[model samples]
Target: MTAKPMTAAGASRASVLFPAVAAFAIGFGLIFMSGLVQAETLHDAAHDVRHATGFPCH
Candidate 1:
């Protein structure tokens, strides 16, 4: 069987929107939660993310 070609019509709004919304929610949640905690706690949590994203933090 032959493979079908991809088209713009095959892309749904939810496919793109879901990731954006999820990321926004995660960021908002992190920010909100951090405010409720201490600096050391936030730093530890963000440290993992920074390394994962290849961001340098000292």
Candidate 2:
């Protein structure tokens, strides 16, 4: 048996992933580029996030 060629309908489904990947890249870039942030501020933010996510950081 021969494989079927790809059509726009199948290709369109793959396009849905681009926005989610872009959003993750943008958010991570913002966090990484904010270098002037104080250590205490970063620690507090991380601590808060850990608690919010129920992840043990200690």
Q: Give one digit per residue, the lDDT tens place, for model 2 in 1-58.
A: 8966768665555676897799999988766534324466665667766556555444
Q: Model 1 compared with the native: what TM-score?
A: 0.37
lDDT of 2: 0.62
Off by over 4 Å in 1: 1-12, 36-58
lDDT of every model, 2 decimals: 0.66, 0.62
User: In model 1, what are the clashing residue pairs, if there are any?
Assistant: none
